[model samples]
Target chain A: MLKILRKEIKAFLKDRRAVMLTFLMPTILITVFALAFGSGGGDDVHKIALLVCDQDKSEITKSTINDIDSVKMIEVIPCAYDTAIDLIKKGKRTSVLIFRKGFSDSVKNLHPLPLDFKYDAARVQETGILQSILPKALFSGTVGKLITKEYFGEKLNMLDSATRYKVFAALAFGGALSDNNGKDISPEKIMRVNSTSIIAAQVGNIGLVQAVAGTAVMMLLFSLTGMGGGLLDEKEQGTLKRLLYSPVHPSQILLGKMAASIIVAIFQLSIMFIFASLVFHLHIADKILPLTILIFATAVACSGFGVFLATLARSRSQLQGMSTLIILSMSVIGGSMVPIFLMPQWMQNVSVVSINYWSIQGFYDILWRQLPIGPLFLTKVGILLAIGITLTLIAFRFFRKNVMALE
Target chain B: MIEVKNIQKSYGEIKAVKGISFSIHTGECYGLLGPNGAGKSTTINMLSTLFPPDTGEITINGLNVKTSIEEIKKILGVVPQEIALYSNFTAWENMMFWGGLHSINKTDLTKKAEELLQLVGLSDRKDEKIKGYSGGMKRRINLACALLHTPKILLLDEPTVGVDPQSRNMIFELIEQLNKDGLTIIYTTHYMEEAERLCDRIGIIDSGVILAQGTLDELKRHSEIKDVIVVECSQTPDEAYLISKLNLNVKVTDHTVYIESNDSKKDLTRCVIGCSEAGYEIHHIDIQKANLENVFLKLTGKQLRD
Candidate 1:
């Protein structure tokens, strides 16, 4: 047993690629996961941006904005109402807070405040966090005003009889919202929060849509990389030379493999979505056209990545080592393992470099956001195609220079 | 016809084929006989246009190898030293895949694949995956895949390595028939007998150089000895003493004395007398006509297997 163990150790050490990857894989994974999940680092915190449209322009509105912005995890950007709505429509901002014209007056007269909070329904996690934070900020702004009699007397003198009558009715409303002690009214009643989605989800669950898209792209990336290993196998078996010995060019062989891989990727994604639809009630049939196009574009990109990896490595073991490290790292950074929003702000910036980010985002637009086939959707498809084409070109060049050169 | 003019290939500091030059005529069976790492495969690779030489030229049938690689590929078939067939694929499937690379249509490719399988004597097992095949069977199929396009020239790099004798002979006969049908062939092997049996002309290469190349008779002259007298004895004779006494080249290995002879009759008589006088008891005596092995040994001062 000792002798066998020694022999195994020697053999393992001899395969430098395997040994290097054995150590490298875990080190890289732990580092990435720690960077993604660890806290206490100031820059690592993902500050959720809240767009504030303060039409009231009152002391109360200013206090509300300051209180919300004081939180370490939220950044308040004051903008006009039109600008806030535009930003939400264009997907520039996930959440928005609107203080209508009569917000400050209503607060003083003990009337229901006209405060509107709108968020993108697709970003359920981000909105949920925002929803929890928004109330505390509003309550803090109202607490100081409610504690002083001068705050109520000032608004009471400016009101007419008809308005005062309404104020009495509003006071009755506020009385019912208060707790048994009557001093501690809930944050919901304090601001009369009118929360709604800027763009509502067409699907039943946004999380399921996220799961189907994320898993599909991530798994396809892995499978396509494995398919790339076929190139190394041909090289080892000397079948690559046999193919080269034919009238075919090196580029043709690489492109042929890429094409086959793309077809397989498309098939893989189709099956994943079909399974998702049948079992999980994902509304894929309604968005079949866009989904098909997205899958094809994604497949092209992933197949390119696969061929690139195959051409990059000299042997099957090396390819295995490299593909595992690359695919896993990309999957994690690209929001396949976890949502990009949940990661550090820096990681979210880095996620755009990964192919998974674009592919998964494209699916989210169709399934979760129910986005139409417009410029935004086309841009995603274009980026994926560009990535695929560029990777294929690099793979071709590598095959010609390194592989076909017959070192 | 193929012409290789001082074609040199190098990988970094190691010159794989150092300015080696040779030519093959139409319908000629030319052999490159060398030990392992003797530039045989490098020369074949250059001729096949797998890569271009650093500073030389190769022309195949009036097309430059560097510029007209695709044209050359159309007429050349290569059987690499390693088994190049896809193991997961059956003999028929591998043939079809290779044949299809030549842009051969389905009907003709199908016909050609069947014919090649039949030629390799693997028609019955055409549908069997190659991984299940013996070394010889895989080799046979490896050769067959190259011939599906009916290339004018075939390059076989040690085609019979690790093959059983039966399959080796079968491969030999198949190559012989291909040559007889007027296909140009460049066969490389360390096995002198295979070269002697198949090639019309053979080139003996060593250390990235063609040490000697010619017809069998011409190469045999390099030995300068007509025959070798092998005397297995209880005690070996000193090589230097035997060489001086018998006036011939002598090599003593173990309990055997090998005497190279220009004149077998006179030389053999002198060898016997010399060994007797030297007190070496001869257990057996055998005479071998100087073949390529002896010629190779005489030139390189090492055994072919070395």
Candidate 2:
């Protein structure tokens, strides 16, 4: 038994790929997770730039902006309303806070504050973060004391005795009367936040959109690479040599693998979207044509990436280890695992090179931005197709010089 | 016809094929007989255009391998030593895939796949996945895959390795039939019997060189070792006694004595009389003719299997 154990151990140790993967996978995963988590909520690491158009320019709006900036996670950038709008439209900015033109008279006289919050619909996570923080920044501390005095001291005193008692009872009861227990206490009315999604105005649920697109993009890459590993499997089985023996160019074989992977990826993406639509009520019918094109381009890029990685590795196990490490790293940095806004600036910059980033971005344009098939949308698709073509060309060269040599 | 002229291949410092040349007439089954690592597969790989030789040239049907590899591929089918197949795919599916690679149309591919599977005697089990196939079954499918294109030339590299006797015979019969149908063949095997049974002419190769090439009779005629006469005695005798009595080249192992003779009939009479006069009871006498094994032994100084 000990002899067998020693032999098995020696065999396992001899397989350098397996040994490297055994230790490397966990180490890399832990490092990636650490980087994402460390930068995810840290104030210094991931600072969300909040574009502010101080149209009011009042003492109160200025103070409100100052309060928002005081929060460690937000960086306040003051720009003109039109500039902020342009930035948001171009996807350079996630959210923009606008203090609409109003005299300081409203806050002094205890009237409703005029404010408008506009954000990119695709950056739904950023929207939620701003929503939670903006209210606290607006209503907390000195601002909250003044608003509470006017909101309750003036309005409640004006109510009739019986109505006031009923209102107080409902507020104290805290069940089924949370909304009706008070007058004009809803978040929208309190902040006068006419929140508008400058892009994809019709998109209802951005969470489900991101979930579908992000998971689909990441999963598509995983499956495509797995399929690409078939190339190495063929080499091992000697079928690749047989194929080379036939009257087919080497590029044709690589292209055939890419084409198969693309077909499978498209089917996988379509099925996932269909399931998302059925189960999660994701709206797909209106944008089906653009979505299909985006899916096709994404598939092409991912399949190319898969084939390229296949050519890089000498065997199937090596491909598996290398692809898993690469795809997971790409997923994390590319905003599939973590929202791009939550990642460090450097990681976001690095993500532009990953296939997952382009794929997810293309899906976002179709589903979240709802941008028509215009220059912006086509550019994303074009980049994906270009990446696919470039990787495929490189893979072809490698296949000819290395794989066909059969050394 | 195929002409290999002074072809040499090297993998870094290891010279696999060192400036070897041979010619094959159309429809001739030429065997490359060698032990493992004797460059047989390397030569076949070069012939199949899997890789190019480091120097010299190969021309098939008057077309140079360097410029006409694509054209050559259309006419060449290679059955490698390893069973080159997709185990997850059925035998039928594997044939269709290879057929597709050969640019065969779907209609013809279907017809050819059916025909080849039938020829391989696996038509009934064509739908079963190859992962579950026995070694012999996979070997049959491996051969069948190569024939899907109906090429003019076939290269069989140790195709019968690890196969049972029944399947080996089946493969031999299939190869014979294909050759008879005017398909030129290049067969590489370490098994002398396989080469003797299949090859019209044989090339004995070892250590990256062709030691000799000829017909079986011619190879035997050229061997250094002559006919062997064996005299098995009832009791063991010392070598000195046999050598002193016979005064011939005799080797004694246990109770048997082997005598090399130019004339076996004359030597056998002298050996029997010598053994009897030396008080050694001759139990049996047999004469063995020069065979390919002996020829290989005389040339390489090692057994064929070694």
**What does the lDDT come to for candidate 2?**
0.83
What digit string (tens of lDDT, one per residue) describes model 1 on residues B1-84?
Answer: 989899888988999898888899999999999999999998888889888899889999999999998889999999998899
Off by more than 4 A, model 2: A1-15, A40-45, A56-67, A101-114, A135-194, A200-204, B104-119, B217-223, B233-248, B251-256, B262-282
Docking class of 2: medium
Docking class of 1: medium
Residue A374, model 2: Cα distance from true site in angstroms? 2.3
Residue-wise C-alpha lDDT for candidate 2, range A102-213, written one tens digit per residue: 7255556655566668899778777777776665565553444455565566665565544443333332222222334355543223335567778864456666776788
Off by over 4 Å in 1: A1-15, A40-44, A142-179, A182-190, B229-260, B263-285
The deviation in Å at residue B231 for candidate 2 is: 2.2
What is the lDDT, from 0 to 100, of the residue B294 in candidate 1? 84
List TM-score per model, in order: 0.88, 0.85
lDDT of each: 0.83, 0.83
Question: DockQ for all models, in order?
Answer: 0.77, 0.67
User: How closely does chain A match the true chain A in each prediction, as TM-score?
Assistant: 0.87, 0.82
